[model samples]
Target chain A: MNLIGLGLVGFSALLLLLFSIAKRKSPVKLRAIPALTRLYRAFGLSVEDGTRLFIALGRESLITPNAGAPLSGLGMLRHLTERTSLSDRPPIAAAGEASLALLAQDTLEAGYQAAGAGEYYQPTTGRLTGMTPFSFAAGAMPILRDESVSASVLIGHFGVEAALLADAAERENAFLVGASDDLSSQAALYASAPEALIGEELFATSAYLGATQSHTASLTVQDILRWLIILALLAGAALKLLGMI
Target chain B: MRAIAVVLAVATGLLVLIGYFIPTLAPIQSMILNWAIILSGAAALVGVFNLIWVHWGKISRREKGSLYSAILLICLIATLIFGMLLGPDDSNMRLLVNSIIVPVEATLMALLAVTLVYASIRLLRRRANLMSVVFLATALLLLIASATLPFGEIGPLNNFVRPWFQHAWALGGARGILIGVALGTLMTGLRVLFGADRPYGGK
Candidate 1:
């Protein structure tokens, strides 16, 4: 890794720790529904009873220093599953990566146990949808059309092919909420014009939705470090212009 | 277990981060990178197994498009056997994959370019007012600029076509967008850190 890459990762880790601490102390509430959330809810309203909440997670680039998006997205799935347990409804999670699918199973099981709905938890229910971006989209899109999907949330590392799924959700009048920090993926989901959280925002989703200490700690470290970096860059530029080195 | 995972995740993260800044840490960085690749590769194998199991069920049940499943199974087994037994240096299996898989994947991706153009055309056809017209014009110009053109001097047109569209306008806008994205990412991170949002399990 180069300096820029190191700075990016260290800064991200520092922020993760900060956010985690912050989450431990104070949990933020998103009182107003984000536009995508609202759109998804509206889509859900038209669906039939017993329709499941479908979530597709893509782990396209986990090797990259920033694994925040998929990790946080997993956290969100945990939150969602807990919420789902309170109701008579069941949700289906379609994971793009097999490892994530296994994690999702555990997370969902944990959520159910926490909510005292452990009886309803099934390993087969949580599925590994597909591997490639196109294959996953192709597989998940059909669920939206043929099966009654009340609400759909795609949170993780996805590619432009997400557009197909988003479009399918829209056509079915199913609620669709998407969050991806990757720039290329965001561009593909234009019709939904998803209210995406860029880069570190993906890391913050768990804290944003459910206040985790790890997240808070990271967030805090990031803020302080970023400001320092900005200041240093400005000073350096000024020094260079003045030939003071 | 949770504590261990957190500690390990953070430790690996820090090591990788430091590896970027210090030349001496390059080996550590390389090791981390290797681990990441290994982990993902392991995950891919899991995915392949899942794919095979799912498709095998479809085949047994005589599900629609089971022919595709058959093709997939045949290819998967054939490729695995050839590559594993004959070795990449000796087998023609690698060539088959390169010729077939690469071209098909590339062609599928090329379809996206067509989709974008089609979308633009659809939007233009349903123009209701001023905003639509501007969008249509922007789309058209962007398409024209992105299309392959020779570097040979077509006078002022070439200058305007490449620089204004590609370098000055697009590049500047892209750079600005990236910065904005970075800032937005930073804010979201801050929000999480400050406990303004709670998406995690333990409040």
Candidate 2:
């Protein structure tokens, strides 16, 4: 047994429980994240104006270390789908991995069902743009033109190849919000994307997009853990400096 | 149905998690992984079909990109047929991949380098915030320092500035970001394990 791994998991689970209880009494508030606020605003406008929206869920398959970013994108997609289900032209999802594409379809359907608009569900909305990273970006670039997408969120496991998609969105004059797990992609996106979520901000999509109280609780737990980890790192550095090891 | 899905998920997660801890469950873990690999391969086929279907619609409806779709379909069909007959390890299959996919992807990567430089300048123009200024300056400094002049490496830039920025500041910031990302991933996974968050069809 990896005792340290088990310990971390247990600690996190406990924090989640504590936060969940606390969440019931009062609302969980997060600091203003302009990226998300802008995205939500775009969603409202997209629906109201009957323009299309695109979400490029990047190339990483679900069963990898890079899966978390893509999964976060999926969570956001589910919520966004529900919100946009009533629109004349709902959001389109483009993914690189085949399985992720399958999951995106399922998520979209679930979202439509949740919105009580299952009849409006379109399977083509969830598309496997390409199987490879660069290919995926190339395939997804057309959504801006073909669908006349006015807003896009490039939230996924992307590499430097993400810049191409961002450039395409820019050309269309679409509101572009991007976040990725990989550092190179993040940097590239930061340069091109007007509203870029840096670092772990991408993972906060579910909570920011109003998924559930549980998501808020999870976010709170994550916030606490971040502080705890920071303290531990600083303490470790101090101890090492003192040669106390 | 949702309940069944949740039960299946929890059981699979527990089995995999516990199997990692106890050596006795290694065989079970290996078997489960094999199942996952098979499912992944099947899903890839589904993805290909989905691509074909979408493109087919484009062609049938005489959409704007119908000609591109036709070309893509033709190429895809030819490649698949050749790949099946020659097999993946065959010289012809290698030739096919090396001839087409490699050069295109490599060209895109080369294009990326130029785009990144342009993007940095564009960043400053688009957003003149503190972060943007810092980002552009650092990128410019790194570019200059990393390059070899007619004489040699820039003394302070290469020996002190670049090294300090790369080794200390960048490394520290990257590690901090990584820690946060890891924590988020762990929490998200745990949320699913606890059945508090169902990202599957159940949600």
* Root-mean-square deviation per candidate: 5.5, 1.4
C-alpha positional error of residue B163 in candidate 2 after TM-score superposition, expressed in Å: 1.2
- Candidate 2 Cα errors over 4 Å, as ranges: none
Candidate 1 lDDT over residue span B37-117, tens digit each: 787778778767766776687689887667777887898898888889888786486687689877765765676556545
- Model 2 CA lDDT for position B94: 96
> Measured against the native two-chain assembly using Cα atoms, what DockQ does each of the candidate structures obtain, in the order listed?
0.23, 0.71
Candidate 1 error regions (>4 Å)? A1-33, A39-48, A59-61, A85-90, A95-101, A124-133, A143-146, A191-204, A211-245, B4-36, B56-75, B82-91, B118-137, B146-158, B176-203
Residues A125-150, model 2: lDDT tens digits: 89999988888987898877777799
Candidate 1 accuracy as TM-score: 0.71
Candidate 2 local Cα displacement, residue A91, angstroms: 1.2
Winning model by TM-score: 2
Residue A67, model 1: Cα distance from true site in angstroms = 2.7
Measured against the true structure, the TM-scores of the candidates, in listed sequence, are: 0.71, 0.97
Interface RMSD for candidates 1 onward, in order: 5.8, 1.3
